[model samples]
Target: MRTIALHTQTSEQIGLVLENNDVIEYVSTRPEVRTLSGSIYLGKVSHINKAIQAAFIDIGEERTGFLKKESVPWAQTSIEGTLKEGQSITVQVTKEPSGTKGAQLSADITVPGFFVIYQPYGKRTAVSKRVDAEQAEELKTWTSQQLGKDEGVIVRTAASKVSTQTILNEINQLRDLWTRHIKANTTDRSHKLFDDPILPDQLIRKHPLPLIKEIVVNNSKLGQWIKQRYPILAEKVKWVKSVSTYTGISINELQSKLIQPVVVTEQGMELVIERTEAMTVIDINSHKFKQKSLSSYQKLEMNKAAAAEVAKQIQLRNISGIIFVDFISMQEKKQEKDLQKYMSGLVRKDPVSTTILGITRLGLMEITRHRRFSNVSEELSAKQKPTFSKDTLIYRLERYLTENTQSEAVLVAISSDLYNHKKQLLSNSISSKIPQELFVRHDASIIDWQIELEGSLDMIQTVISERVYHVDNLF
Candidate 1:
């Protein structure tokens, strides 16, 4: 279940609902915050960089509007041909600017809300894929009859169960707003016609708090705004007098907890997930599990549970791209199949879609997920706590070697700045166990070492043969 909560001021007070995840609640009375999602903009082009195939437009903010060549209108090919310095252009803000990047803009405009996307220049009305074919035809017929010649609405996923009048009303409202904007900007080439609403207004419009369980707010102005816009949310709002009260702890105490270790446990095993620029890597440790005491079936079951948990964590953290899961090897084919089935089931619960490629012979699972925004680590981590970590580097190397193996066995270990820590440890642990005559190589560029053994060309073939997986673990 997904629930959304809205908080006012600076303190994060959003709560997640346990039953249905789609609903979010926030406290804000500002009308600007309520409907800023589909607002269009008439901006002034500040600069164009033909070399980078990008342009920066002034949108009346601290940051500028970003327009890439690919985002330009289909009729416009080259930035040099389409745009000029100080020229005014109509652009739609796709995403808010963060960090060094400016707000993302597109020449193609789309006005999106809960139920529909209104395209000013579109020629067709389309239904959402989630809508059933029969229902879609009925809605289409109704919409066409009501809209007549107006053919710019694209029904969204939220329109599946909505009333026709509600969709039409929203479209008309958006169209009226756009008309006013165009009229206001027609003669004014030097001024910015549209600017994103302030943060408070944006929060109200884009973040729906009704679906959320609770909201915490620190700023009195914002709290009042919430009460004015959404009286229903007022009861659920909690006011935080100060930042300290908002965090539920003193600054010093919270700082102390930042450096504390995070311990995760499951089925007598422990694991840790570390962040990196390329991808997040999770390390599995048997920990207290006595060797040979647990059957292969039991061990595989435990690993499947662990994998499911990790998948949930990834979704919670909004991690994306390549994810590699290392599981304890099970020689039995049924055990491997069961583990794969369980893991896939767990992953299906995620709101975002994921693809689970089955385990390799080396006991590694390859997974990929779509990313709509930055992951949690990227959003929250500071400069001092850079995204890279020793654990992540080792796991990535292990995953890479396992997937990219050729004719040789690859052994990898991390390198240390002081006295060869990971290198010495890996060499000591596996050097005597494997063939001594194998080719060895040390990569000091990053934190890991790479060791390739001879006569393993057949290994890659075997690993590829065992692929059988799908994402259904969450069920």
Candidate 2:
């Protein structure tokens, strides 16, 4: 089953692509950490370093954006001579900010639509390589005819599946969008020109619509909006109160254990993954298998399963840069060659440019995935720790209390520390959204929040009154 599960709760939104019950790509986005990959900015050159031949740009973001010399398409001679400090420049974000680095800037701007990407700085037409050679040639000929002397349009893979007129219309639409929304902003002040971070649009840009069998979302508001906005996908959109309801998998568990060093696949194969500062390393082990000894074919199958799992994990964790994977040792060169070929083919499915550098003499499979954004470990590791702040506890408690809308009234017993924190914060904002007949019992000895009762208002109140009496009594 090919499914896109969207979990929107609290401040973060998570999107997971599941193929046959396995997660291949896991994307997490928050308002504060939103990606700027396709954003265009009207920036000013803050400073220029002659030694590094790079310029620091004020893109009206938290960090100073970095623009290298090569990224400046119109640059000539030296960086100091070509660009002046405080000069206004137009640039596109090629990569999102990772770690302490700012968004990667490029002078070459490209605006993408459903079927075509309009490039104003180009002169040649390009077709996606995934298209058949004959079809690609035809698309190239037809698309090139539509381009101007200085403009270009890349015929995306979706264009091959669509009509020539549809592609042309999209090209025009994208060009007009750029001209009106981005290019028209000729103000000298540093500001963002264009940024489209819609969740449905973001998913469509990453995964082809035809390949998506179903899209399950947790938020009812988002689910309804998607169906209303795009009636074409109304059938494919499924809304559930809980994200894990249809998948039979815990979204919270998947997220909590995502950064773990060990993972076990359904085939009884254990994968030990170590991510260091330099590279990520993975080892496949069959210690958990039931069979005491396996045949050569069985061993190969294990290795194959491991290879596929490694690819899935790589994308899910967003592991990038240098990677080394070690499968079970094989004696035959043919098996090794076959494994390499199979693994290479699997990695090709990744949206990011991931290359299989082939097997090393030490029996390590070498691969490199281009680093665009921070890995899941970098963002999730800290959050996964047991030590959560009082604010986090409040959020968790609130999520737990109101998860079941069927409950008419609910009462929860919470620790004094948590109750104090919630009271200290916006108490009205926190309490106004919950059930009308809700009661909170603050116990000094309690370390966790426990749901006391979920029933009619009279029943819940009686239960809380009894609890208060028992607490007051020494017995």
Candidate 3:
């Protein structure tokens, strides 16, 4: 059975996890403002670097969005002074901000709908490759007849099973939205004209609702919104408490284990995933599996199992960009070829575009995945070793208490030495937020920056120290 769990209890942002039977297949979270993709902006060109043939556009955000000259539809023509520093243009964010680099933008924007994607300036109509060849040709013919010469549409896989009226209805809605955006862009004020929905709504629009066996949302407000907005899915809507018992691993277990770098399989094979500034490296080790007396076939089977887990972890962690995987070496060329093919097929299932570069001379597999947003591991790593000031700590403590309304009083356990250092800051915040009762359970075993909160912190709390130690040793 297919199950989707919407986790909003962690913070204000929402997270979605797709599971098949009892195993996690996909995981994603709503991005913050700095990393927002698919947002349409009316931006002013800031600087043009002729050497690189790229321009930086000021989208009224913290960082400028980078627009390549080739990506600009008008830049291809012989129009002099077409893109000036002060010129305003409509662009969509194709990539999120990574490190110090800005967001990637494209002038050719396409608005995606449930059944089709409307390309305002596109030349020809097309169908999704997932559709069969016979139906795809028919869809192309139908699109040519139905659409105007100036219009273009890309029929989605969902359109193959949907009615013509449904496709037309979606096309009309998208056209109206585009028209409104164009009208708004003509005004003097520059702003964000459009943005894709949050994680939950995006999933609903991207996938057929009928295919999902159940939708469980942890936040009551989000669940109510889903029920009211899409009454057709109301029957499948369930509260967080009602569905907590269904997951193979409890939410807390998933959160705790997510921060770890190593995954041990049933046969004791280990897959170590490490993310660095330049690239991600995955190492497969069979030290424990070798203890058992097994033939070469059994070793290959273990390697295949490790390959599947690596693919799952890549998607689960949202690791993007260059990836190098070192698998257990096989002496036979036929076995090596089979392992390479198996790994390629597993990665093809990723939602983000991924390219497998095949096995290198050293037997390492190279891969490249389009970065969408900061992966779950990256997000957690950012907060793992943060240095907070007095005011920041107070603010965070207040925010945490306010967000978790279910907890009347929280027992905070921390190192005595660290507690003494921030005693004033903690007391001040506790006095304001927790008027009823405040308990401080100090233990020397707790390290600096380590915090333990008991009662109703299932989603917000993360065992950072435990995972950090494992990562430190692994690296």
Q: CA lDDT, every prediction?
A: 0.57, 0.79, 0.70
- Which scores higher on lDDT, 1 or 2? 2
Please name the candidate that would achieve the greatest lDDT relative to the true structure: 2
Instruction: Using lDDT, rank the candidates from best to worst.
Output: 2, 3, 1
Per-residue lDDT for 96-166 in model 1, tens only? 67679777888767655446666665556788766899989877666665453534677765566557776
Clash totals in order? 33, 0, 0
Q: Candidate 1 or 3, higher TM-score?
A: 3
| lDDT winner, 2 or 3 | 2
Listed in order, each prediction's TM-score against the native is 0.58, 0.71, 0.70
Model 2 stretches astray by more than 4 angstroms: 31-34, 48-54, 74-86, 96-102, 196-200, 218-242, 288-295, 383-475
Provide the lowest-lDDT 10-residue window in model 3.
466-475
Pick the winner on lDDT between candidates 1 and 3: 3
Error of 2 at 209 (Å): 2.7
